[model samples]
Target chain A: MAGYKRIRVPRNTWNMWLWGWFLVAPTMLGLLILNIIPIFQTLYLSLFKSGAFGRGNQYVGIGNYERLIADAQVWHAVANTLLYTVLVVPLSVALAMIIAVLLNGKVKGTSIFRTIYFIPMIAAPAAVTMVWRWLYNPQFGLINYVLTQLGLDPVRWTTDPQVGLISISLIGIWSIFGYNMVLLLASLQEIPRDFYEASDIDGASKMQQFFIVTVPLVTPTLFFVFVTTIIQSMQVFDVIYMMIDVTNPAYERTVSLVYLFYNNSFRYMDKGYGSAIVVLLLVLIMIITYFQLKAEKKWVNYM
Target chain B: MGIASKAAKAAAYLFLITGAALMIIPLLWMLLTSFKTVAESTSMNPFVFFPSVWRVDNYTRVLNQNHFSAYYVNTFLMMFFRILCSLLFSAMAAYAFARLQFPGRNFLFGIVLFQMMVPTQIFIIPQYLMVDALGMRNSIFALVFPGFVSAFGTFLLRQFFLGLPRELEEASKLDGCNIGQTFLLVMLPLTRSGLVALGIFTALFAYKDMMWPLIINTSAQSATLASALAKIQSAISVNYPELMAASVLAFWPMLLVYIVFQKQFVEGIASSGGKL
Candidate 1:
């Protein structure tokens, strides 16, 4: 056994402190200058009236908010976003949970199945969207091809306003299911084997075992997956952007809040108003997450 | 213990097999379609999984037309530096949070945790403005610099580091090593699993990323493979062959990484999801 002693901070140790701060400083500083500061800048920009090239941003406090409240398009985008969240979160979580449960069985080639499911999770989003676009094509697309084989009329995916959001949401559902499935599967594995063994001893059927044991045990992971899915759906952009042609007639129905933010900031260069919209989106996310957390406590089983 | 029970097990296998097949069909279809000619690709009544006559030219055409080589190099470089920076910063911060009794450590960690909930979307506008102000647009740095710090990575690593047994650090201290030395030698090796977990995630997100690169890198040469894959659409008449070939190439590396490290990767993300 070696003698123990608390090492004193050598004079050079201040250099270590300085170096640690220095190493960590760029990142924290970047986050501040780039992220945190911009958050405030966006808030401030929201208050201002924009001029050409986003220059001469004059202050008109709450004026932008007033305009936004009265703006139907903003509300439409909000509704579209909320609808997307509603569509994606539950669909993603439930489907993922079901698949995870199905996979939790001591089946052969499970790892291969897990890999197959996770392919969409890693594939380039734009590429995946393009493939889906091809599939969604009413003419000569695989989806319509399949539908026609089933003797159904071809559905115009991105072009038709009625089915566009649903079509986009379908892709969203496909892409995210694997990630959630793996999450739930991990949670399901954590469930003590004894729980199932005991349930089986008590004459529980497979379904009952799932309900009484698996469901309760995996609720914590399920809640996590749910909250994250909701949060992700609310902020979703890449799929919608790549899937829906912004110039098409269906744009009105498909434009998400982030897409609208992108349009305002990049396309139109209405930086000030765009900033305002982002701030509002942030506030909305925070409030929604708070509520989700409160709700999770009621149903989530931490053990 | 009867033949009837054996039949039930077989049914379970059948259900799982169908589910697995459904999951793999799109990928298999994409691969098969990539080898088919334009006529075969658009065929309505083509009851063919394999191409009647394979055209290998699509891969060549996509490679020649797009500056794909440059994009691959740039994307990989971005991933390498981004991962390196993220690991270093996150580990250092995590170590401080886990082991050090510094002033305002918890408060600082709280700030990082808060930042995780604030979506990257909200930060993009302000981040973009700053990048524009710095005149770093269309540069690789613009693509990789902002991503160097990850709140989630720091938080996850902190959890892993905290869960580490303190005995190693105590022994190292007895050997007259300082905090930095102990962290470098003892703690770092002990937390290898967490590091690998962080690495896989960093690599996955960094490589698959499109939004930031799309916004930041306007020049084709500087853009990533993910961005390069989008070039398939700009050319008239969907070239399924080359497009699928390119998509396959783009999808292959990460797929290989995941397959190679499936156990660690799955376990890492699963546990991280639970903790975070």
Candidate 2:
């Protein structure tokens, strides 16, 4: 039996080739047809402008790219997305880190608190945005209701171009705060106790230990949060789409790049422009990802 | 645990309580609004703290009207099938990539990784055209078709498989098992937790999906819960209580799942960042 098994082993390698093909065929075919093919198709389609309805598409080459650069609305969207990322990345991580640190202790209701915090992450973006829209409603929303109770003027949370983007950011922070908190808290628990114990023996205060020992150990997870928050913030669409009503005049200020992509492609039927916009987004994401991967060596402490 | 001082514990409690309250305020307000009268939910000036009389009308109204029943069924059907297919196809491909050697493996793997990085909206326009060409638009199949398998799941599960010791497969090989047998009998079952984690991730992604569902399915008849809610939100307009009620109703399935599988739900998310 052992001799036969040894002889059969030589054939198993060849069999593995067939088995591997069999195993991966479904996903491979799906990826090629749904992902890889369409990816190139989008790129190809970008070079040509679509005609009326389903008529023939015209070759545009770099014409769409030129228009994208000149389009004021597109630039405005890029600026809005970048600015929102700047505002959200820091606050989401910092606020969540504070909450995570507070909850990492051996206290009662930690799980309960953690559960409550993660609810927004669990809910759909539509659900979260809808609720927030009600809260930010000008005349009778909960937020304005609270402001008026404080004897202050009710500010337009989702209106007034000045603060519309800010309103979106606040909602973004609130939604992501719980998610970042839980992830950071889980990573905090993974940290070894020896570092803290050693710091304690050296007479480091609790606050000092947090900065010196805890912070260094958690930097890897922190970097993960940073990359995640940055990428996600740049891609912010569902919330903006759901929250800012078309009638709400503040819509102009809060339009994100993805939102613009949707408009040019679906609403305006400017498929070429939409393709260029997304291709630009794709390149931006790739560059950002490349830099993040390179920069991880500088400060992301694995040990 | 013993290292914590009483004073520090008290401070932690205070901080956590306040933050937790802040975390839940929107959901709490949503729940309250869902139960309030329209006049109470949109009450201005004085602002009603609690409804003078709690009403169940919004729940009944939303469930009975606004095509709520169809939306609920469609969403559940899409979620169930997507989760089932994603797990199966992802695990098969992940096992092959992780364990088997084949020609062009590196190139194929690179494509999977690239798919993982691109923003999903980038896929929408052409995917919509593809679905339209297939004459499947405004159908649940189209809503679930492009996502029939997940590149992320394949990548993540491959990582899980690579972490396993080689001896498990070798030992199975000693029993005259084939590569397929080794994967099924000796390997795949061992990756249950990894599979569960990926399953939860898949479910969450499908549930929260907005743009794809909204764009692909034009009519309410084919709408998933998220798209249905988006439609209802636009159609219902500014009736705060009903909107809140619809929002809360839209959230019930997820809330129920979270409550039941709290640990998996939290860990699936806490699996950390880049889920999109």
Candidate 3:
């Protein structure tokens, strides 16, 4: 009986092991082919000048990288992408934090406000950008009309090189803050009621309690939101792509890394150069994330 | 509460109301403009608030003359398959990663995490090349190709699966159920919320996906709503009414779904925030 028990146990273990592999096989295979393999392939392809229709390729080791460094347009793209991230992340997060704190209180119409704010996050970027474009039109736009009503000169929202990135960033903040708000609100709710009660007992004012209790407790989530939002903003493509055309004067000022990669890879068919550009984007994200992680220990408080 | 607190609460309400208005004005403008005539839409001197005739012609014209219908069908088809595949494959893989013991599990999951960390553009060039090699361009299959495996869904669902009580699986095992049976009968049903969350996210991501469809399916007939809207915007840059109409048509389905599943959408998105 004991020998039979041991044999059955081993057989069951074998069966479980086989099933585990079977269950994971499809996803593993898909990721390997589509995602995992491609990372290396992109790295390799960046080395060679891609041939037409993806055929005969001549290896140009470090050549694409060299071109990427000297290319003024590539630098513009990097600067624009970073600037977009810089402009979008802090303002959106701060606004989201404020909104989340207010909504966390005994506020009426909380869900209604949430629903309205979140609409832009789910709306197709192409569609959202279209509406914004109409509104941002220098001539006959509602915004310009409003400006004229207020006795101020109508500002060129989408056309001007200086204003284009800012205009796109406004749309970025509008679309994204709701998502951050939801995240921050979730984290806010996780804080125990005891903390607030204790702070109140200690003669802490509402503002003081918020600064002393709420902010410290929510830092973990704040950190997460900041990291993810930065990564997301770094890859901004659709809104800019829809709003700014290559022929537009603001194209150089507004073109992001992903947009540049898209133009090079598909439009110009310079896949090698595009691959190199995207690799630079990947490195930048990793470095930023790495620093964020290292800095988390200093400010992010755990409860 | 003191008068000071009352004043603070009022200030909060004011701020929230203003923020909400800013959030919704663009959408309200889109809806209002779609019904206006081209002249009315572009009018600056008076700035038409409501359409003079409240025309449905823009909607009808876009639906009838352009590729809007095709975009609808294509986008729906792409979303449906992408959601279905991601749920099935991700659940299976997540179950294994969360519950099953296997060699190289950590290494494999590391790969998944690596996939999640990298910018999606890194995968695009090779994925495009792969689809081209398979002659799958300009097809629904091409649109649905890259989403067949979702590392994010796997990671998200694995967290859900891990949170389930282990005793249930033990009980099913003691009842003479095998590993597959235990997973299917005792475990899978418990992760319904996780499955739903993943599904909601997958659908949303699939719908708003612009670059892939734009790159893969260049033809009007094959384009998804997002890519098609982009095409029309570029094609008819100055036709404000038609463009607004196209924007409305492209986004209303998602808006409708959001309205109906408001609670679930909030919970799903919020849950993602927690796990991340």
Judging by DockQ against the true structure, name the best candidate. Answer: 3
- lDDT by residue (tens digit), candidate 3, A133-160: 9999889688888888999999999989
Clashes of 1: 0
Q: What are the per-residue Cα lDDT tens digits for candidate 1 across A174-212?
A: 888888998888888888889889989999998898888
- Please tell me the interface RMSD, in Å, for model 1: 2.6
Which candidate wins on TM-score? Answer: 3
Q: What DockQ number belongs to candidate 1?
A: 0.49
Alpha-carbon deviation at A183 in model 3, angstroms: 1.6
Q: State chain A's TM-score for model 1.
A: 0.90
lDDT of 3 at B101: 87
Q: Please give the distance, in angstroms, between residue A135's alpha carbon in candidate 3 and its true position after superposition.
A: 0.6
lDDT of 2 by residue, B1-276 (tens): 465687778887888888777778888899898898877776675668798878899889887777777788888878888888988998899999998997777888888988888887777777888888888988879878877988988987887788789999989999989888899888999887778888887888888988888888888688888988888888888888888898888898899999999998787666634322
Which candidate, 1 or 3, has the higher DockQ?
Answer: 3
- Greater-TM-score candidate between 1 and 2: 2
Worst 10 contiguous positions by lDDT, candidate 3 chain B: B267-276
Q: Cα deviation in Å at residue A153, candidate 3?
A: 1.5
Tens digit per residue, CA lDDT, model 2, A101-165: 88786777888999988878879889999999888888888888778879999998887999989
